[model samples]
Target: MNTAINVQGGQYWKSDNAKTWALAIAQLVSWGSAYYSFSLLVVPMEQTMGWSRTSTNAALSVGLLVSGLAAYPVGTLIDRGHGRLVMAGGSILATAMLVLWSQAQDLRMLFVVWAGLGVSMAATLYDPVFAVVTRDFPTSFRTKITLITLVAGFASTVFIPLTQGLVSWFGWRGALIALAACNVLICLPIHLSAIKRDAAESRTEEHKTRIKVEARESTRRALRTPTFWALAVCFTAYYATFAALTFHLVPLMVERKVSAGLILVTMAVIGPAQVAARALWFAVGRGVRPAVVGMVVTIAFPVSVVVLLCAGTSPYLLILFALVYGGANGMMTILRGTIVQDVMWTKGYGAVSGLLSMPSNIAKGIAPISAAAIWAIQRDYMPVEAIVLAVSLMSASAFIVAMRFARSHPGEVRERIANVGANNS
Candidate 1:
């Protein structure tokens, strides 16, 4: 029961659990509103503007590219106690960008809006959010991070349907405008109000004290380490395949003759299962090695694909595939954050994970377009599924390799902590 940090006061650390959950709720709503609205609006946009899906999807790619590139610097900024400001500003900017997007009449304007959305993402998304939690609640960060992601998982389900409703009621432009207003009205106020920091921060002093004792390593030096590349490859390969699978899931289900309603319902399973899996993982996580948990999750990628491939004619198989695939996808989201924290201390974490993740996030941003292009060329999902399965297998291999290296790597965790301490100092 350590007291919360108060630089000027003697008050003990009180777990800002309420504030954390509030932040999580705001995160869920904001991300849901921003991301989930796209799919629902895409068709309407295409119909009105006579734009191809490819053209519309390209805007998303641009935004994601920007978001990926901005991840590292944003992480660094968050570590430096700028998270609240970044989150607030980003929320406001996102609202403004959405307003602009609602008014966009051309692809060029849409691209501009999404690009700004990318900057907004850099400012507001999980990296910055996770940075705050990780720095402040190192011991309990696993569960907290898992919970935040779990809650946010519902964003797609909540906002996607809401977007559809808005479009149905008010048309796409109005829906976009309404969503933008939501960003301002709902998200902005919550973020601004809940994310207050003390002027005299004790974590700053803690970080400084910790950093001075740790060895300094350049990013290059860090990258040269086997664990670095291993993790990068692992995340990249998994996410690339995962992204493709998600983008193509509905189409794949349709091809399998699953009913649209069933597919939609099944898709909804991912979010709730994500939360449930995190809760389960938290309940039993102490019993297993984290790397092992990661390995199991990675293994699910290929298994789920195999189930889907086998699901061609069987409804039961498809359901199974959904359960496994969706649950794994949901849980892995938490594991991504946990894995980085488990591998190192807060020192250099923001920079390292952010930089390593850039390419992976780029893959995430582009995977949908790439998958579609492949589908067009091949005229079958088998190729895509096969590739994802292969990549998943490789990623699992990389994770196992990385774990071995991590086990043997000396001083990495300590070094990271020391670096954070120094930076804070």
Candidate 2:
């Protein structure tokens, strides 16, 4: 199979750089409108609909859970060369659901809209986009994936303020309608234009047969490995901790008696800090092993949480926490993008990654609501912080274990591929 052929002559953009930029833009819009926009809408929805914050936020949890459930099938589809259709369809659905959510008059309606958005998320969000990059830009996929995250890291920075402005100018409902327009006008076109159609048509039957065998063997091998399960556990716990902190950060700060202005300043630092971290990674950390990066960032999670816990009316400590947390989160995204290729070969990268992401996505979906329940029971953020810190430590430990295991049993798939080539020769 010729990797360069797809880049040179296919339905995708003629240049790899062009395709990368298009997908990066698409990711920014998709994430900004679909996922990050939800948090900004929570207060407005609660105020207008007279629903409790928990009830309103539950809709997002439902959507994320649905997204996690749908991830495997969506990944399988992308593996089958349906990347363009799946992503474009997802954007269209997201647009429709956002419009529906704009007019939601009841909690049930909100749930319905968000439930549909969940499927859209599985199709449009990071997992699907990462799969597309892996499939399309197999040679330079790591750099491309990093570039996408570097841009999309600003999803919250872009949409939080934009959503707030829209709400202030035209109310929450009108703001949602405008977001729907973004999905349709921005995300859908970029996905459709960027993803190449099936490249199997350009390959010989022998090459096609060899690729399929490799993909199947890779998936089978990955499923049977302890490394795969360890990574799953590590990422699941990490995402749960991240989601809980993200959703509850403001409230947690408030409970500590931090003023609203200081809270905003602290929160605003996170986005830029994330972007700066990614830029640094691209400049200096790209040559490092992803497992090394993973272990380092996982440690940062617990340390950042501890800083937040001990901030105690110190704005400097809070800012320091934001920098550490944001930088680690940013680098973690790049690690996730590259780690599968590092630990395993890229034969069935999309499917293998999807399998790994399933539990992680589920954890992300459940973390916020579960953390809220914890806060309700304890009546404070301290216990919640402790819970997150414990999970973060567990996540770090699991990744370290996985890295050691990979070191002892490196290139399992690569060895298999080598043996196959020798037999063929």
Candidate 3:
């Protein structure tokens, strides 16, 4: 086994396996506390604070927007041997932000708090973690990535009920405090201890400059590709639908007259279903083509939404929606990490993935507010549901269009991109 100098002055890659699991666990907690817990808190906050749905949702929207803006800079920091700093600092800041969020006394406070939370997300979430893993573990990264996502897929399953139960015991404010404690106690230690970079990557400044220059040119080439834009559209549309549904699902089910117990159960079904589908895909992923998987995953999105729309008051169909929706959403996570590499070259994945994340993160930021606006129009979620269903279809269509451009010619397109970069250089 190849080894590099550790910070301790003596040793090698002793913590690769530990690093993988620690990052996975941190992602699960970070996402669960910062992201999934928002929906459950919405109604409680609205009832207690007398805030409009739009008003409450706007805070998170702003946070997500900030997250989008912070994505690139965070990636750049990770590129500079700061993975431990970024993730550990993100965990600490997330703890502080969650505490502040619990004490939010006004709209301004909520907005400010969530904006900081967004920055934490940019540092700690899947993209940043993936960057650290890819940088630290060049070989066997796909398996590691798959395992990381597979574990973190249970974020919703575990956090949703745990949050609701917290709310039940001590109200929204208390629940957030509990969450903050969990973030600090669980994530902070793991991030600091587990994320160890190989010292050999600390090359001379000239080597670093050359890599950056090449990465910039590669990004430029990707920008000119029709396939990249289609993926941007596909992912943006997918995220819009995803965010809208995630932030609005509980309320939508309530409006449809679903029981509180049933709502929890259905929502809980999502995480396990997500894990199961991901495990299945992980087993058979290499045998299948990415384009085929992409199409199937995209098609699954609208199908799940249609099921939700048609379920009405039926319990069985609602569970069916959870299964399909959760599975699709899980597979989408894997696709999000892989599709960019499949369609584009992986020479500068962090930079390229951050670029794709910009629009998608913005879509996530806006989707909640957009859904709230639609709900406000008729004071109904049916309209919002219709919008979600439409966007899901739009995402599927965008992927189909993207496949048309690069499906038969991924290798050819990659060669062209490399040649263009070489010529430009």
TM-score of each: 0.88, 0.92, 0.87
C-alpha RMSD between model 2 and the true structure: 3.7
Candidate 2 C-alpha lDDT tens digits along 1-425? 11223444544465778778778888898888878887778888888889997787788889888888898878777766678999999999999999999989999999999899999999988888988888776667888888999989888888888988998998899999999999999888788777887655535677557656765766788888888888899999999999999989998888889999999999999999999999988788888878778878999999999999899879999999999999999999988888887776666777788888888888988999899889999698889999999999999999998888887776665685455445334
User: Pairing residues by index, what is the TM-score of model 2?
Assistant: 0.92
lDDT (CA) per prediction: 0.77, 0.85, 0.84
Model 1, 1-425: lDDT tens digits are 32344444322224577657767887887787777788898899998999998888889989989988988777666655666778888889899998898889788999999999988887776777776677666667777877788778778768888888999999999998888888888777666655656455535777544433332343455677788788889988888898889888999778767888788777777667666676777677745768889988888888988988888756677777878887787778777777876765555556666776788889889888888877788688888888888888988899898888888865866676565567555
Query: In lDDT terms, how accurate is model 3?
Result: 0.84
RMSD of model 3 against the true structure: 3.9
Q: Highest TM-score: which candidate?
A: 2
lDDT of each residue in 229-338, candidate 3, tens digit only: 99999999999999889878998999999999899889778888889988988788856877898999999989999999899878899999999998898888888887
Order candidates by TM-score, high to low. Answer: 2, 1, 3
Instruction: Select the stronger candidate by TM-score from 1 and 2.
Output: 2
Clashing pairs for model 2 are none
lDDT of 1: 0.77
